[model samples]
Target chain A: MSHFTETEIAYMQEQKLGRLATVDAKGNPHVVPVGFRYNSELDTIDVGGYNMGKSKKFRDAGRHGRAAFVIDDVLLPSQPRGIEIRGRSEAIQQGGKEILQNENVDAEFIRITPTHIISWGIDTHPYHPSSRKISS
Target chain B: MSHFTETEIAYMQEQKLGRLATVDAKGNPHVVPVGFRYNSELDTIDVGGYNMGKSKKFRDAGRHGRAAFVIDDVLLPSQPRGIEIRGRSEAIQQGGKEILQNENVDAEFIRITPTHIISWGIDTHPYHPSSRKISS
Candidate 1:
C-alpha cells in the first residue's frame, strides 16, 4: 500500500502543472514549470516534451538517477504547504496523437516512480522570516 | 553579454527558488521546487542540498539534457510571468570542509549553463488557467 492518502494524491493530480528539478552538467540545480499526468492505476506519473537524447534536461535525467517534482505555492509565506516526490526516469512513447509539440522534444511520456513523499503544510515556522527564508 | 536583463537576473536571484523540469527514465515529465543560487559573474545557477542527490528529481535531470526552470506564479488565469531556462547539467565537485558541515554536499557545487532563457511575465499569458495543477 502507498503511504500517501488518496486525498493527497488527488490533490496532486488535480493540479496539473508543477515544477521539475534537474541537475546541470556542473551539479547546479535547474528548474522549470511543466504539465504532467499521474497514472493513479499504475501509481506512476508521466511527464515529457523534450527530445529523448538531444535535450539538455533529458540528458541530465539520464545521468542523474534521481529528481523531485513539486507543486503548490505558499500564500502566507508563514504557512507553506507543498508536495514533493522523488523518482527515477525511464523514456517511453505514448499516444498516437501529439498534444503539445516543441521543436526540441517529440517524446510522449516520461514516468516517475516516487520513493518519498514530503508534506510541509503544518505550522512549523515560528516567524515570518524563517518561513520566508525556506519558502524562497 | 547575456541576453537576460539586470531586472530579470535580480528577480531570479531574489526568488532563489524555481520549478525544476526533469525527464524520468520512462520519458515522463517531473516537476519540483528547488532552492538555487545564481552567479551573475559566471552566468550559472547552482542547486544542491545534503539529501538532494538521493532525490528522484535529481535522477531525472541526469536523464534529460534539456530542462526548464520557471519562476513566478499564475495569479490570474490569463497572466503568467516567469522565466524558463533551457540548459545542460554537468556534475562538479568542489570539496571543502564547509560543504560537509552545511549542505552535506561533499562535492560542493553543481552548475547549469543556459542555452535559451524564456521570460514570460504578465505580458505573455493569454487565457491561461489561474489555478495550478498539483502532481507528485
Candidate 2:
C-alpha cells in the first residue's frame, strides 16, 4: 500500500529536493538536504548519494535508526504547504531505485519506510494540518 | 560569538523558509516547515508562530529540547549547497522577538541555540562540506 495520498505523492513528485533529519548517538539532531524518489509498491522513499558510505548523516541514521524528511513549497506569501515523514531509515548500497533523476548520485541509498506523516495544503487536508499513522 | 559566517548569514537572509527537526518523547523523529530569524548577537534562531503554543511541533520541541534546522538551495542539478544547525531548543509563549519580517506570525515561539553547524555550497568554509563548533 502506498503510504501517501495521490495528492501528496504528486506534490512529492514535483519537488526536486527534501531535507532529512537524523540523530547522533548522544541524541543531537542533524539535518541535511536530500534528493529522493518515492517507491509506490514498497511504500518507501529512497534517498541516494554518491558518498553515502562515509557521510555523517548516513552513519548517524545507522545509530539512531529513525529519521524525518520534509519538503515544502510557498504558493504565495501566506499560502504555503508541505509534508513531513517520520520513518525508519537505513543506509544501503543496493536494492536502490531511482524516482527523480539526478546526475549527482549513484548506487548507495538511504531507505526510509514511513511510520507517520503530517501534511497540509495541496488540498489533501483542511484546517492547516493533518496527521496519520502509516501502519501498525 | 556568532554561529554563522557572513556568507552563511547572507545566504540565510536570502532564503524564505527552512525545515526544523525535533524528536518526541519516544525518540520518534519529527520535522516541520518553520520560518525563522537568525539572531547574530546571541548566535541563535528564534522561530515564532501564530498558534505555536498549541502546535504538535512546539510540544515536541518542549519534550526534545534539541533540534536541527536546515535550509538548502540547489543552484543546479549537481551544485547543491546548504546549511545545517544542531542546537538546543525550547518552546515558549513569550520573550520572542522578530528578525525576519513576515505578515503570517505573532506570539509564541521556539528558540534554537546552535552548538554546531555544517555547511556546503555557500562558501562559509574552504572545504566542500565543513563542520565546526559555533565558537572558534
Candidate 3:
C-alpha cells in the first residue's frame, strides 16, 4: 500500500488549515492551527504559521519531538472529515531564511515524519475506521 | 474582567471548528478537530465528534482530566488567529441518551472547564498576544 491511501492524499490537498499539537515541559498538551501542505517530494508535512517562531508550539516541539497533526473540516454541510497523523517532529529553519506572510518575521517550520495514521469520514460512504501504523 | 475577553468570544462564535488535544497514557499528545460550542451558561466547552466514544481522545479524557481546546481561523485573508484554552476534562454521557447523528450511538461528550486562555490574532489588529488565567 502507498504511504498515504489515495483518499487521504486527496483530503490533505483540499484542506489548508491543520492543528499541530505538542507537549509542554509539564506534559500539558498544546494544539494550534497552522497552514500546511504535504510536501510530496519529502513525503512529509511542512507547516508554517504567523509568528510561529516565537510561539509556544515552536518551543514545545523543539523540546519534545513527538507531535500530532490534524486537518479537519466541518464546513461541507455534510460528511465532517479529518486526517490525523502522529509522529516525531522537529522545529527546523530548513533551507535558509524561509519567510512568513507576516512582515519582519522569519518562517517557522516543523517537519513531521509520521509513524501512524488515523482518520474518519473523508470518503463517499463516510465514517469508516481506517487507522494504521507505518511500517518502516 | 470577564473570563472570555470580548474578542475571544467573537472568534469562538465565528469559527465552526476547534482542535482538541488530550494526552494518552504514554503522555503522547493527540490532537483532533472537533465540532464544539462555548456554553456560556455553564462556562464550559462541550465537544461532540464522529465515533468519539470509541476514539482514543475520549478514553484519554476519561482517564485524564486535563485537555486543551484550540479554535483558529485564517479566513480573514490577511491574518491567522487562534484561541487556546487549558482546562480539566472528562467524557460524560450526561443527562441520559445523548444521541449521535450517525445512528445507534449515544452522544460521546467531552466537557472542558477552562482554567486558562491564551490567544493571539483574534482582534481587529490581529496578532496581539492575549494570555490569561481564568479567574475561578
C-alpha lDDT score of every prediction, in listed order: 0.57, 0.78, 0.77
DockQ of each: 0.24, 0.75, 0.80
RMSD of each: 10.4, 2.6, 3.3
Model 1 DockQ, alpha carbons vs. true complex = 0.24
Model 2 stretches with alpha carbons more than 4 Å out = A97-106, A125-127, B97-104, B124-127
Sort every candidate by DockQ, greatest first: 3, 2, 1
Worst 10 residues of 2 chain B by lDDT: B95-104
Instruction: Please state the error at residue A22 of candidate 3 in Å.
Output: 0.8
lDDT tens readout by residue for model 3, A1-136: 3578788898898887788889888888878777777867767877776566777887888788888999877646766778888888888864313422334444667778889988878654457747889976
> Docking quality tier of candidate 2?
medium
Q: TM-score of every model?
A: 0.52, 0.89, 0.85
Q: Which stretches of candidate 1 lie above 4 Å from their native place?
A: A23-29, A49-55, A62-65, A96-107, A122-136, B1-3, B10-70, B78-80, B84-136
Candidate 2 global TM-score: 0.89
CAPRI rating of model 3: high
lDDT leaderboard ranking: 2, 3, 1
How large an RMSD does model 3 have? 3.3
Residue pairs of candidate 3 with colliding backbone atoms:
B65-B89, B98-B107, B121-B127
How would you encode candidate 3's per-residue C-alpha lDDT over B1-136 as one tens digit per residue?
Answer: 4488776887787777688999999888898777777767777878876567788888998787889999877655667677889998989865212422334443778889899888877753456758888767
Evaluation by DockQ, superior candidate among 1 and 2: 2
